[model samples]
Target: DIQKKKQGTFLPKEARIQPAAFSMAQVAKKPLPKAPAVSIQEEEEEEFKISTGMEPGKTYTGQKLDLDLQDIDLDNVFRLIAEVSNLNIIVSEKVKGKVTMRLKEVPWDQALDLILSTHKLGMIQQGNVVRIAPLKDLLDEEKERKRVKQERLQAKIEAAKRLQEAEIEAQERERKLRPFVTEFITLNYTKAKDFQAQIKDILTKEPKLERVGTAVVDERTNTVTITDYPEKIERIKQYKEKVDKPTPQVLIEARIVKATKNFARELGVQWGAQYAEYDKRGEWAWGVSSATGSGTTPPVTPSSWQSGSFTQGTGRDFFPLSGWMVNLPATLLPTPPGIGLQVGRLVGDLINLDLRLSAAEREGLTKIISRPKVMTLDNVEATIKQGREIPFTQVNPEGNVSVVYKEASLKTTVTPQISPDGRVRLKLDVTDDFPDRSNANPITGNPEIVKRQGTTEVLVRDGETVVIGGVLEETRATAEDGVPWLKDLPGLNWFFERKTRRHDQTELLIFVTPFIVQQD
Candidate 1:
């Protein structure tokens, strides 16, 4: 019994209650399982560092990437947008561990044979870091955060990439401008001859002149003058911007001669900016100013006589156009800006004027609208009776009244006619889609014009009205006073568009047939 109690610990209680076949020795004699080697992960936990923010060395506390992994690759656009992350990696168990240089910002879940990318690993939350990889690689992370975090990361990355690209483009432009510094110089000259003389004067006066700065000034009187020597001048940067090609419009070559104010006169308003020159009396000259040039706005280029024209505004084909006016050239010339869209608009006023569609062009359009083949003709008539007989009135048996077939009289209309004095008469048009005989029907442009040829279905897209002449002329009551029920009378705007189908052809015929009224 004591032995049984000791064995009870080794054997399950239920098993002990039952009759057992093997003893403890037999059970011990069975081989023990070789304990499998377990790779202790504790040491690996320490090697990883947490980072966040712009700091380079810090490790993210924890992160998760949420990406709606599309089937297509974003083509490495990840770097162009994300800003926070510094390093990213792409991993593959295939190729016996091959890797590509993972530039940051890989998209999530693109089609790749077998490759995974990670922005952060090592037991971090990963919410802040944004990286992109294939859909299959999503499980590769040691840990993952929620989806909202991934979107934020992606947006940041895109913004960063855009800024970086802009910087690079700017740098390239500066490189190009480096050589032009020696060759290009700004000088204010009134005439071509004067400019040449000014350059010669510059050669004699300035010593070791690597670069020169010039500005245009106006005389106290309304003439333009040039100031050759500038005390302190800002560099004229040549930046590359995408500009659409120019289209033709009215061209004007004018200067701001008469400004509204003395202060505006002093600033040398630029011709292409959003400023006005008001005189001391509060009167003003509109358009652009040249005294201070663009001021806070962008620049307006000065025009040359030959290449002087520039495109103005947008989609504006003519001058003296809406919200714009004309200014004569050789007025008060503002400082020469190379040219701008505004200046182009100003120039357009003088040279091109406004070129609206000419009379000939308008007439040409009129001829087309009134041409034959465009306006098809059809025959319309009344069918009160067979063989063209008049309709008559009749009373039905139920004490009800009705119009007999002979009671109705039909008025006739022919095609447009010209008088006998050199006037050509137009006969009633019998319209047919195909050259065929007209059935005894008096409808215009039958929808089932080819019904004889066997057409089963027709789809009505739109419908219109063709008024009968006599029905349109008659009014039930005075239209002037519109007394009480007079406006509600049947014939006033009460007519219906009539359509009937032929028995044999099933052709649809529409007519402006007449209807009678009931009197009190």
Candidate 2:
């Protein structure tokens, strides 16, 4: 068994001894120490380095060793190493184990490390003295050292934080004792009363000025009076400068257009041929005498009629003797001065006949444009209107007639917000009102009111126009004035009737444009 020693024995510095060989006879003379029973718990793997007492980057130049030993006392191996290296060695009582190693021409330090590793041992060197111990004890000692170092570092950081807070508190106390200075700040673009509460809130939140600082506004002079330390007053002034600048303005231009289109066609053919038979006296007579019978003809005449054929021979003008005849043009005649085609034909020779035809057509277009422009500050609303008010008569239950006026006008309301990048956002409400006299109230004789409204929001670039349209109205009508059965006839309808066809269309379109107004 290895004996416990009070102090580590040192070899003389000049005595660099090396044993040629180690035999079992020499090793067996000393009884091997019993291996300590170590219980190692599972832990997270960590990287650690032992202090070897050697300066950084230094190489070991000790003598090489060749050894073949079995069941050798571990403590005795360390003593042999200390003699060869001429260094003091201390071995822990817990470092008790038997080492069996075969090392060939290895450095003395490496031989010691191999034997220590085979027996689960570790070492730390101080100068030329080396101490050996169980690996588990060495690891526990290293962990405790790191933990203590961390605790000390944390304590130092906390102390520094407390010292800094104390310094801040002291500064705050000193600032609270300073004299208060009252300063007046005159605002150019913004009102002083608008910022009074905001400034007071800022000062009240500050630790040093919470109790003493005050902000008051004088509306007449447009100035804010601040009672605080000089530095704090300057800070408040800087903050005011940021938010009290000028607000931008936007000009909104809107155009409302109402277009009306009307188309009408009046086709009428008023054609008639009259037949009269004359007696030998050569005077016109309304009666036609046939060999079988004769009678007075009815006064009403057909719109399209033909009778008494006229024969135009060479240099000979012949009138009808047995039948009524008249000459009628095949094509449409030229229109008359007023409205429709008027054709009148007369054939002479004891026969008086007249033919008249009429036709008319018309087309018209009308456009009414209203331009309204309004300017307002950013995020403000503006309105423009142009129109009249109509009065309506109302009778209450007491039979009293009272007149109430209602607005019939074109109105536009817009709210514009100016973006930082020179774009405009618009909220629009447009209304158009008019009186419809075609459908009047029967009891009151008051015209009906027609209203058109639209509301929308849009984003547009500056100086750009946007158009909105979809209000449309259309009407179609046809009228006929003739005998009911005759007007519907296929081939002869045009000659027997007057037909009128009308088409009307109306549309409303709005164009909006925005311009950023630059202030001087």
Candidate 3:
């Protein structure tokens, strides 16, 4: 290993460990890299995600609209950048009344920035997604963004450290050199020595190239390919610095000191904690989702729930909610993998779900039944971009046919459950079978989802009424066609008593969030 040089002693200039001509005056410590004036947290905040309204591959004109909105009211206008020429503005001039405005200009990006900056009151930040809403939403986003300001600061610090390292490395290789060249390349690399020998051989064969350039480095895979050239080089073209080339001997035998507690704490088990912003759909609600359809919407519902057969002591509802609802299989697993032995604590973190303010359905109308967690992202696809070529001998029949079975998946379709986030989420999962649902449609890859659902039918009420063609004969009241039948039962919510279970049994509760039904 290349040991760092150790200091002999702190003495007079003459007693120092250096050439006799060396003096302390030549080295009054270069100010410690400006102690990064930035505070640790502040350093992190500097790592901002950069984006621009200015677009490339576009033509510009003198008549450009610069969208610069500096101050804005939250509940008034919905600003939308629809196109390069038109800005679609949905404005709520009055309560529940909306008017769409399409403002046009040549340089749309300029117009957009100008308008935005002009009305720029502030911005709202959440998670990594920031909502540039008016004062209220912007304030909320800022509160959330700043809530984790400490974290943001730390992230900035780490990013700055990385940048500093990169810049330093870049500056180090700024020596007087020539551009090393390697012409006519081929993969013939072996050991470094052998590679060097090969380079020499190549140079001996072709004299036009320059002195063996710094081994053509591939940082992507920390490996270097020796190159042969005639002259020396200045700086690496795009790559400004030469990677530190450790000797092979050093690599053969290296010692790794055990990581310290502080180090471990810095990069420890990174867990994902799922939680929505500190608010619900009180005035402005939002959510998005999708549901898989099945059984052709119950063949148009030929009949309704008939309790008249109670006299026969047999049928009425198929099986409570099971006949219809069927415990809508989650976007993921059915019972959500239990949180005990069988499930990994990190698994649920990947696709976390929660419903802080439960779904509200007041009237009998089914539309208010389940307000879905909006803007759902479902992966229903599998694709093999690289196809394997099947090699075969001449003797086999049907052997030459390369079987390329395309990936198929369940077409999990979702409706456009609009929300402030502008993503689709809420889903009405209509199905028939309880346990074995979605059928054997092996959802292998990205399944094609239908958004505007018009297939499923919501059967409210339908019954058989036998009548003599337009002749209305007086029928007995409270009787089912001369057959005595029990009266329709009133609906009720029967409470199922709860019972405690042993610690061994699972008790993981899932939170289903209503992330869709929000204010526009």
Q: Best lDDT goes to which candidate?
A: 2
Where is model 3 poorest over a 10-residue stretch in terms of lDDT? 464-473
Stretches off by above 4 angstroms in model 1 are 1-27, 37-241, 244-520
Which 10-residue window in model 2 sums to the lowest lDDT?
Answer: 352-361
lDDT of 2 by residue, 365-418 (tens): 324356778888898888867789989989999999999999998776788888
Please, what is the TM-score per model? Answer: 0.13, 0.50, 0.14
Off by over 4 Å in 3: 1-221, 226-234, 241-406, 410-520
Better of 1 and 2 by lDDT: 2
Clashes of each: 71, 6, 84
Q: Which candidate, 1 or 3, has the higher TM-score?
A: 3
The alpha-carbon deviation from the true structure for residue 368 of candidate 1, after best TM-score superposition, in angstroms, is 34
lDDT of 3 by residue, 367-465 (tens): 111222223322211111111222222323655533333322212222323334333222322111112222322533222221111112111111110
Model 1 C-alpha lDDT per residue in residues 1-520, reported as the tens digit of each score: 1133332233222222110242435433343233233344542333323322223453333222222222222232232112112323222222122223332222322212113223221112233333333333444432343344476689989999999999987876664344321232333223323333434433213223433434332333322233332322111211101111121111111111112122121222122223232223333222333223223433223331111222233222222234322221222223221212222222222112112112322433111111011111122221121113233344566867565342222222223222222212222211112212234234332222221111011111011111110000111232233345655667862333233333221111112111111112
- How many clashing pairs in candidate 2? 6
Residue pairs in clash, model 2: 307-324, 307-325, 308-324, 308-325, 309-325, 341-359
Top of the candidates by TM-score: 2
Please say which candidate is ahead in TM-score: 1 or 2. 2
